[model samples]
Target: MNRRTIQGKYEIFLQKYNEGVKKYIPIYRVKKSIHTWYNAR
Candidate 1:
């Protein structure tokens, strides 16, 4: 594979990875907040 093609593939992978992270981060934040509140009690 050429450098350009490899870079393109990497970019696509990064985009998909970011999308997955974005989708899950809110859920993660909610869980983290709940955990912290429970621990604070």
Candidate 2:
């Protein structure tokens, strides 16, 4: 309802989003590498 509360919520949301992305980065990298290898083959 207040500006500070809204900002805090936004920060929390960003933190969770970043963490989720970080967790997925390795999986995505692996998939990308496999795709590239297959394409080269």
Candidate 3:
């Protein structure tokens, strides 16, 4: 309803988004490594 509340929600959303990205990057790296290995073979 207010600017302060909206800002708070945005902060929370950013934190969750960053957390999700952190979780995703490792899996992405692993997949990339596997793909590279498969191609090499």
TM-score of each: 0.50, 0.50, 0.50
Each candidate: how many clashes?
0, 0, 0
Q: For model 3, what is the C-alpha lDDT against the true structure?
A: 0.75
lDDT of 2 by residue, 1-41 (tens): 26568789899889999999988877533443455546645
Off by over 4 Å in 3: 1-4, 27-41
Alpha carbon deviation, residue 21, candidate 2 (Å): 0.3
Indicate the TM-score of model 2: 0.50
Candidate numbers sorted by lDDT from highest down: 1, 2, 3
lDDT of each: 0.75, 0.75, 0.75
Name the runs in model 1 displaced over 4 angstroms: 1-4, 27-41
- Least well predicted 10-residue stretch by lDDT in candidate 3: 28-37
Candidate 2 residue pairs in clash (backbone atoms < 3 Å): none
Shift of residue 39 alpha carbon in model 2, Å: 23
lDDT of 3 by residue, 1-41 (tens): 26568789899889999999988777533443445546645
Q: How many angstroms is residue 40 displaced in model 3 relative to the true structure, after the best TM-score fit?
A: 30
